[model samples]
Target: MIFDCLLTADAAWLGGRELAGPTAIGVREGEIGWIGPLPAAPDATHREHIEGVLLPGLIDYHVHAALIQPEKLLAAGVTTVMDLGWAPAEIWPLVERARHDPGLPRIHAAGPFLTAPGGYPSRQPWAPPLVAIEVDDPAAARRAVEALVAHRPATIKITLNSQAGPVVDDATLHAIVRAADAHGIPVTAHTQGSGQTRRAQLAGVRVLAHTPWTEILDDRLIADLARDTTIISTIDIHGWGEPSPDREIALQNLRRFHSAGGVVRYGTDLGNGPLPLGVNTREIAALTEAGLSPTEVLDAITGAPLRPGAPADVSVVPGDPIANPAVLGQAGAVLKGGQNVTDSDGGG
Candidate 1:
């Protein structure tokens, strides 16, 4: 039997500082087929009166899938996540499984770190085998990216942690960016230690895995980065929930960048520490501290709106997140791709 599902909520957050009151949203074949005011809604085969503020599914811009259970993330309103660092051979299978399984959040992956022979993750004990490909020169860097094209990485990532062993040279970094551009892939970078953020930005890196925390950024440099790149906010990872100098430094840097019209994406460096499994309210609180208004914060976490033709991934929270940003902590009910995922305990 073919049936369409309708969900009615007291209010809905439509992103970009817009909110609609008393809404009716319908889903057909895993996509939003209809949406309007509750009084004007058409009949559906099944109707549910969800009792909460409705919003689009949240997205975690960075995570490592291998470290946690996928279902937990979906259960907590994180309908999508990006696997920023993992071997293509290992992460690709997980990505394929998530495409058809409601049990997992939709996955976007960047295969491995393109780094200098003895760079960052290569020496970190926690990084898995094959998690990084070392390149000695520009030719090797380009070739490594070309190889990843077959596996279809969502984007290319480079490591420039000068404090931890060697950094990828400028020629090699530019080669990585050029090759990724040839294939229409954007490049993300993890910058650490002194001057690395400036180096990454100058090299055409479109995304920063973590906001620069080691040193304060100059006004001109921060302005340029705001104009050219998107920064992933992994603010709480520096101290988990505790306050630290690094956390304070990053928050200040982000504060200025945001005021300068920078783009910030919410990404907890999940799996790096004892961070929250689902939506990290700590990260939310940190972003609030970094000067993002509740409305701007909503745009950062839930990158899209709950409109027609959008995937029917709904979030039912306690109150309007814009009014009370922390309400995103526990979604009372969630819909993933038009399916009411909260119906069960989400068991295997």
Candidate 2:
């Protein structure tokens, strides 16, 4: 196949193995057809060269798009994004509409945050009725899960923030988890305050929306979740404004979580406030400060900061890899669905 573009990077993060020498990746038919040393470019085809690095497109597992549109995500090097919480009736149809929108980040989302009656979002003015489900009983929890599954979410989001009003009981949480499991979907929860993480873990939650934000989880709690679940690092979002009590707790919790074998994922509560509309540098910095190396920090945003999927998208630093942790935040070439989406100039 004749490649429409040929990328040469001094270092290329090819599916997790960083190549040390010159490497060429060929894109044909909008997918990576070949990845090897540069052969002669097709005489009839045009080629674009990126001077720095090339890696897989970055993935943001949590973001709210109520404000930011989908196009910005692609321009920012995000090829796939998963919405943590949103209104099902409105967001579902919008997500369906976005399917035909070319080059938009592939969106896999949750219907809404399932919380207890008058939970966290219920008290916030911006928290609309459709943005979260307030379930106070096992039956209500089961109904919420069933309704959300019918809406067709990739996963179910539960809010276990006990500081705000009431959180769902273990029975109710288990009901939601069972209902979601019946449909083969996992549950991701926004857990905070005392025993919230433990409760979620015991109930078989697969992911935590934020690293515990009300207390430093003990070694036992960390090990429990590390053995089974993932914690989305919304570290930057927690410390957004002035230094507050919640931010301090979240920071401490994250430090402990990373210290344990617990997994971490890069997520910015993008639409929560004035956070960057795309891949967040603050988020990267926060994760790096929390103990992640340059590679591990990048991996958090890619697929396997904790698990495995593809290589975190590459960023070429002029200096040695060990010296330039900041370069991981620098956007580089992105490959999504194995196709080159942007070149050196940050355009296709």
Candidate 3:
């Protein structure tokens, strides 16, 4: 069959992790249809030979779509993003837009922050009123989960930031986890303050929106977190391109977490500070500093393979990103669902 677009690259990040010699990837109907060595005589409706590393589009495990436009992410080779929190009314439209527009990074969002009344983000001036759904009890927590499930959130977001304000009680947190589990959705928590990380782990939170930074986690607690939860690395958000106590503590905690075999996903908490709209090299560098090997860091950003039937998203960089993770921030070309989102003349 004639492919819609055929991309030939000097090297392809096979399955988004392993690098393979000269390769060609064919896209059909917005999905990968084939991948193999480039043909000596190519045959396709459209063909582009790229002299760079071709990889599956990167996935930023945490972001706030309302805070940044999709074009910025696409240009940075990020084809998919998981938005942790926003009002359902505000975020759903963006998710819907992603469905119809390949130019936008595919967005999977948690509708709003499920928290106790007057908790965390609700008290933050930047957050809108509807961004936090205040659930006071187990019943209210379950109902809130149900309401969020109706919007088909990628996961349920619960706020457990005692340092900021009132946190959801243990019982209510468990109820939210149980309700989310019943619906086959995982629960991620924004854990803060003393013992909040332990509480989230014990309550069965599957992911932490940010690495716990208020206090250095004990080895035993770190082990528990490693066994039970994946932590989204938003360490850079604590520093915002500058060094501070929070950044140091978060880096220390994350290093311990990584040493204990914890799963770390790439994220920047983009909207919380004056962070770049695209892939933050600082976030990548921070992950490396936290003890992630070069390959592991790439795996965190790539997330999955670019196999047949997967979304036709690809990022071509001028050089090997595994050698210098920062190179990822400057993509030479980016494609989402077989369509070119950005391309630079000099192979940026």
Candidate 4:
């Protein structure tokens, strides 16, 4: 069958390794139909020659859309972003837009912040109305989870920020987790201050929205978390480029977390501060500092490989991304589900 588009790259990243290519990737019916060397490539209606490397679409595992525009993300080569907290009413339209528009990065949204009454973001001046669904007890927590499940989020987000305000009680936190689990949904938390990480861990949270930064985590807890939980690396949120004690503590904590084999996904708490909206080089630098090898770094920021039948989601990043980490922040071309969304000038 003649595919809709054929992409030939200088090289390609597949299965955690970079293969020297004249790699040919075919897209048809909004999915990848074939991947092989050019010598064995299938016929296509059109060919897009990539003078750069082809890699799976990058994913920023944590972001909040309240302050940033979605179009910028696609241009930055980020084809997907997980928005951890937003008012479902405020965020759902954007998520729906992304689903139908290749020009926007797909959003895997975690509906809203489920927190204690008057907790955290609700008190932050910048939070939109109803950005959180606050609960005071186990029963209330379950109901909030039920409400969120109806919206069909990628995961449920709970805020347990002792440093910011009153946190969800253990019973309530457990109820939220149990309720979400019953429906096959995982819980991701924004944990802060002492013991909140452990509380979330003990309550069966599956993902942490940010690496813990308020204090250094104990080794035993880090090891235990590594066995089951994944951490979203938002290390640059502390100060971006400036020095801060919080940044130092978070770096040390993440260093140990990595040593203990904790899974990390690249995330910049975009919109929270003056973070670079997409493909944050600062965040990548911090990840490298935390000891992630280039391949692992690529894996953390990108989705699965270009296997046949996968969504035709990929990007052309300039230069050898593994050799020159800075190139990962820029895109020459980007395709989301087989539709070229890169700028007309080929700037992603």
Give TM-scores for every candidate, taking all chains together and pairing residue i with residue i: 0.96, 0.84, 0.94, 0.96
lDDT of 1 by residue, 49-69 (tens): 999988999999999987888
Error of 1 at 284 (Å): 0.5
Q: What is the lDDT of candidate 4?
A: 0.87
Which regions of candidate 3 fall more than 4 Å away from where they truly are? 15-18, 39-43, 343-348
What is model 2's C-alpha RMSD? Answer: 3.9
Best by lDDT: 1
What is the model-wide C-alpha lDDT for candidate 2?
0.71
Give, for candidate 3, the lowest lDDT window spanning 10 residues.
Answer: 339-348
Assess candidate 4 and give its TM-score to the true structure.
0.96
- Each model's lDDT: 0.89, 0.71, 0.86, 0.87
User: Order of all candidates by TM-score, from best down to worst?
Assistant: 4, 1, 3, 2
Model 2 over residues 17-123: C-alpha lDDT tens digits? 34345666665545555666555434226565667655556778888766577667765677778888887766787677555454566777897888888887767
Better candidate by lDDT, 3 or 4: 4
Compared with the true structure, what per-residue lDDT tens digits does model 4 show for residues 162-236?
A: 988999899999999999999999999999989999999999998999989998899899999999999999999
Question: Deviation in angstroms for 234 in model 1?
Answer: 0.4
Residue range with the least summed lDDT across 10 consecutive positions in model 2: 305-314
